[model samples]
Target chain A: MIAIDFLGAIGRLFLGFLQAIGTLSVFTANAVSHCVRPPFYFRSIGQQMLVIGYFSLPVVGLTAVFTGMVLALQIYEGSSRFNAESAVATIVVIGITRELGPVLAGLMVAGRVGAAMAAEIGTMRVTEQIDALTTLATNPFKYLVAPRLIAGTLMLPVLVLVADIIGVFGGYIIGTSKLGFNPATYLRNTADFLEAIDVITGLVKAAAFGFIVALMGCYHGYSSKGGAQGVGAATTNAVVSASILILAADYLITELFFSK
Target chain B: MAVDTRIPKVSLRDVHVAFGPKKVLQGFDLDVMPGESVVVIGGSGTGKSVMLKCLLGLVTPDRGSVKIDGQEVVGISDREREPILQKFGMLFQYAALFDSLSVWENVAFGLTQAKGMTREEAKPIALKKLAQVGLGADVAELSPAELSGGMKKRVGLARAIAIEPEIILFDEPTTGLDPIMGDVINDLIVACVKDLGATAISITHDMASARKIADRVAMLYQGKAIWQGPAATIDKSGNAYVDQFIHGRAEGPIQVEVRA
Candidate 1:
């Protein structure tokens, strides 16, 4: 009897996971289809772009700056033991432009923008505002989901590009001022070693991360049930899921782009 | 020979919906005629809202057909359903106004977004609808969060009528209002429906609201409509369940489910 019960529990868990994936796949397809369809709400798309991209700049910038500064200091300490301190500039630029800048910005935006999207959309769901949209002959996918998805995918690349520049600047500041390194030498080192593909890869990763963040937020919130407590759960789930997916996608995309 | 060309504005036949082990509706049926006002009365958690959602295609029934204007709406694609949905206008329990938009924008959303009218063209009509609901032009720019409960309901009602729909649904329209305000809303609903000659379907536990707005009253119990009659004859409905519900008595044929 115990063996039967254990197998039953495991089976249920597997089924639940599969069901969630299926639902998310369907939701993604619907959102993408609506994104290209006409009767588009250009004004709403513009508004969401401003919210997801423009309003998110400061936090992403601050995170990138601090990360670059700390990385430069750490790389300097480790490299000094082997008479390789001068190599810190090259490593910091490569690391910031290729990985840390985009990943950190993606996670930060996931926490900030993802949670807000979930809360706002979840509240709308519980309150029946979504249903009201349907009754008024408006498709919630076109009116709500599609715009956010488009804006998030298109604008994260832009935000990540800005973050990459700011992070490199941060490394420059620490390298010249704190390390007693000549500013021209450090910049020359960084420019010589950094390839365009590194920056391009980060931007592509940011686009994927942005799409994941927005999609998770919307899917969880749209399916939220119960009431206030349900909306709260949806908000939490959106952040957790988006953060996890960003990390997972980062790894996969890095393997695709840079594997030996 | 006179042809009876008027089809039921909304109809559901043997509808059933369940969540896990709990069945919300079982073999439920209702037919609402054109230009008629019907009020569905039931206790909390008795699936009144679920029935409304089923009719609106927000919640799909596990079994049965939902029809609008004698055409089957169940199992149809959203693209095919859009034209049929355009006939409906719903006033939600909490007003459910979009907090992201200004009051005027909320009222004009269907016209400007769904019907492809320009904002400039829809603005005057939105203002006219607001005036019909006794709201001043000053209220148009205010956020929904800034409005009182009564004011929110009025804004919601104004938005519902802005498109001049042939069918209007009210989901607990007077639920959270004071008695006087509830009466005022009831009067407004009656006047608006009469002026437009629209079919109205409302669900409420408020007998006062039912008395004021209903041409016919249907009382639901055990997922089936147990008693139905003309509004004036509710006092003499002759069913013990209806008697218990109308009199607000705890002891009756209907048992309240109290979960531990």
Candidate 2:
């Protein structure tokens, strides 16, 4: 009986996981469908862009700068043993443009924008504002979900571009001021090692991460029930799901782009 | 050829909806005439709100149909549902005002966003609707979060009527207010519905609110309308469930689910 009960519990857990994935898949398809359709809400899209992109810049920038600075320091320390400290500039630039810039920005925005969207939409759900929108002949997907998805997908690339520049600049500052390296030589090395594909991959990853963050936020909030506690749970679920998906998607996207 | 002109404003036919193991509504049927105020009264969790949601297409019944003006709304596409939904406005239990929007903006939401009217054009109409609900122009620019409970209800009512919807739904209109404020909201609802000659359906457990706003009363129990009559006759409904519910009795055929 104990063995059977344990098996049953495992079965239940597996089913729950499949169910959540199924629901989120359907939600993403519907939200994407709305994104490509006409009668597009330009104002709502613009507003969401401001929230998801503009409002998130400071945090993403701060994160990228710190990561770049730390990477330069660590690379310099490790390379000095082999008398290859000059490699710090190239490695920092390549790392920031190809991975750290997009990943860090995506995670930061997931925390800031994803949680906000979930909390805002969750509160609206509990209070029936979403229903109110329905009664007023407004489609909640078109009105609420689509704009955020579009903004998240489109703006994250731009944010990643900005973060890449800031991150490389951070490495430059650390290499020149802290490591006593010549600024011009470090800048030359950094620029020479960076490629268009490296930045493109990062931007693509940013876009995917943005989509995941918004999608998770909306899916959890739209399905939230109970009351304030439900909204709170939705917010937490959105952030956790978004962050996990961001990392998973980053790996998948990297495999797709760079696989041998 | 004679034309049949007496189409019910809203009708639910053999509706059944269940959430997992719990059945909220079963074989629920009701036909509301145009320009009538039909209030549904029942114990908490007896599907009063579910019935309303079904009519609005917010909740789809597992079986049966919801009709607006004798036009079947069940399984309709979003494009088809839009025109039907345009005819409805709702006042939610907690007013459900969009906290991000100003009071005037909230009232003007459907008009400007859904109806494609400019903000400049919709402002006067929103202000007029607000005034009709006894809200002053001074309150227009304030955010929904800043309003008192009674004031929020008034703003919600104003938003409901802003588009002059053919049907208005009130979901627990008096649930969270003081008795006097409740009565005030009730009176305002009556006045607004009367002036527009709109069909109104209200779901509430408050007997006093039912007496004030209802032209007719329906009592739901265990997923069915167990008793229904003119509002004046609710006190003498004679059904055991209705009696137990209205008088707030602990001992009756109706059982409260108390979990330890």
Candidate 3:
């Protein structure tokens, strides 16, 4: 009987997982299709871009700069034992552009923007506002979810680009100031070591991460139930799910881009 | 053709909806006439809101027929649902006004976004609708976040009526307001519906609001409307459930589940 109960629990858990995946996939398809469809809400999309991209600058910028500085110091410290301190610029630039910049930005935006979307949409759901939108001849997918998806997918790359630049410069600051490396040589090594592919790959990851952030936020919020407690749960779930997906997607994307 | 005038504006037949193991609606049926206001009153978990959601396609029934103006809406695609939805508007329990937009902008959203009217063309109309809800131009530019509950409901009503729709749904339109404020909202709903000559359906547990807004009153119990009559005769519904609910009694056929 205990074994039977254990098997039942496993089966229930498996089915629940499949059901969640199905629901999320359908939501993702609807949001993406509506985002690109003809009846576009241009003003709302532009507004979302400003909200997701422009407003995120200060946080993303600060994160990139600091990470770059830290990476430089760590690399210089570690490499000096092998008399390879000069490798600091190359490793910092590569690390920032290849992994750190996009992943950190995605996670940050997930916490900030993702949680906000979930809370806002969850509140709408519990409050009957979403139903009100439907009755008013407005599709919530088009009016609510599509704009965020578009903004998140498109703006993250731009944010990643800015982050990449700032991050590399941060490493440059540390390399020249703290490590006593020549500014010109550090700059040359950083630029020469970084390839367009590295930047492009980071931007691509950013786009995917952005999509995950918006999708998780909108999905959780849209499906939220109960009331204030439900909205609060949805907000927490959005941030956690988005952050996990960003990290997991980062690894998969990295494997895809660089695997033998 | 001769009896066509008697056809229901909205009709639900044998509708069944379940969320997991819990049955919210079980073979529920109701018909609402054009230019008539109908109210569904029930206990907290008795599916009053579910019935309205089923009619609106927000909650799709597992097995049922939902018809809007003699056309079946049960399995219709979004393209088909759009025109039908355009005929409706709703005032939610909490007003669900968009927090990012100013009061007038929220009212103008359906007009400009869905109806394709330019914002310039829609602003005057939005202002008129706002005025109809007793909201002056002073509150037009204020964000929904800045408004009190009563003011928010008024703005929600303004938004619902902005399109001059043929059907208007009020989902507990007076739930959160003070008694005096609730009465004011009730009066506004009556005036607005009468002016539009729209078919109206309101779901509420508030007997006073239901009595004030309804032309016909339906008492739903265990997912079905057990008794329905003209508003004047609700006091004489002759059903114990109706009596227990209307008089707000604790001891009744409807058992209140108390949990620690």
Candidate 4:
């Protein structure tokens, strides 16, 4: 009887997983359908771009710069043991552009934009603003979801590119001025080590991460139940889910791009 | 007063809404006439909001038909439903004003976006609506977050009437206001509906606001309309559920769920 119960529990868990996947697919399909049809809201799209992209630049930049500086110091200290201190520039450029830039930007956006989206939409759901939108002859998906998805997908690539450049420059500044490395050789090594594909891959990853972050945020927000507690839960879930998905997708994309 | 049956403005026949196994509304039937204000009063969990949502197509009834002007809305595509929706405006329970936009912008949102009016064309109309709700032009530029609770409610009312919709929905329009402010809002609601000659449906637990705003009142309990009559006859409703609700009596036919 105990074994049978255990098997039942496992089966229930498997079914729950499949149900979650099915629900997510349904949500994605609905969003896509709404996006393609309609009385398109270009004004909303532009406004969201300003909110998600322009307003987010300062924080993303600061994080990238500090991360780059810290990374340079760590790489320099580790390479010094092998008498390979000069390799600091190469590692810093490659690491920032190929990995850290997109990953960190995605995570930062998950915290900032994802939480904001979830909270705003979740509150709207609880307060019945979404219903009000429907009563006004406006499709909530077209008015709310499309602009957010578009903004996140389009803006993250630009943000990641900016972060990559600033991060690499930050490493260059720290390596040459603070660590007493020859500036010309540092710049030359950094340039020689980084390829176009590294940057392109990072940007591609940024776009995917952006979609995941926004999709999770909007989905949780749109489906939020209860009242204040529900909005709070949706906000938390959106941030956590976006962060986890970003990290997981980062690894998967990396494997696809660089696996042996 | 005899029931005037000249083609009811809104009608719900055998409406049923279920969230999986839990039935929120069951065989709910109602008919509201043109230019009439109907207030649906009920206990907290009795599906008053669900009924309103179903009427607006925000929640699909699993079984039944909702008709506006004798046009069947059940299973209608969103595209087919737009014109029906365009007749409606809603004042949400929390005043659900867009925090991102200023007061006037919120009022102007429907006119500019849904109606394709220019900002120039929308501003004066927005200001006029605000004035009707006793808000001034000076308050127009302030963000929704900056407003007091009563002010937000007034702003929400202004936004609802901005488009001059033929049907207006008020979901708990007086929930969070003081009695004096609640009366003020009720008065504004009456004035706005009268001015537009609009069919109005209000869901509220506030009996005072209901008496002031509704020409007729319906009591919803256990997923159905239990008692409905002229607002003046509520004191003599005779039904124990209606009696228990209006008097706020704890001990009666209704059971309040208290989880230990």
Candidate 3 has which clashing residue pairs, if any?
A: none
Model 4 has a clash total of 0
The sequence of per-residue lDDT tens digits that candidate 3 reaches over residues A139-207 is: 999989999999999999999999999999999998899899999999999888889989889999999
Compute the lDDT of residue A220 as modeled in candidate 3: 100
Report backbone clashes per prediction. 0, 0, 0, 0
What CAPRI-style quality would you assign to candidate 2?
A: high
Where does model 2 exceed 4 Å of error?
B1-5, B257-260
Candidate 3 DockQ score?
Answer: 0.72
Give the DockQ-based CAPRI class for model 1: high
Interface RMSD, one decimal, each candidate: 1.0, 0.9, 1.4, 1.4
lDDT of 2 by residue, A135-157 (tens): 88888999999999999999999
True contacts kept of 4: 0.76
Write down the lDDT that model 4 would get. 0.90
RMSD of each: 1.8, 2.2, 2.2, 2.8
Q: Per-model C-alpha lDDT, please?
A: 0.91, 0.92, 0.91, 0.90
After superposing candidate 1, which stretches have Cα over 4 Å from the reference? B1-5, B258-260
Candidate 2 chain B, poorest ten consecutive residues by summed lDDT: B1-10
Model 4: TM-score, first chain: 0.94
lDDT of 3 by residue, B9-99 (tens): 9999998999989998888888999999999999888898788888789889999899999999998998899999898888877888877
TM-scores of the models, in the given order?
0.96, 0.96, 0.94, 0.90
In model 1, pairs of residues that clash are: none
**Model 4's TM-score against the true structure:** 0.90
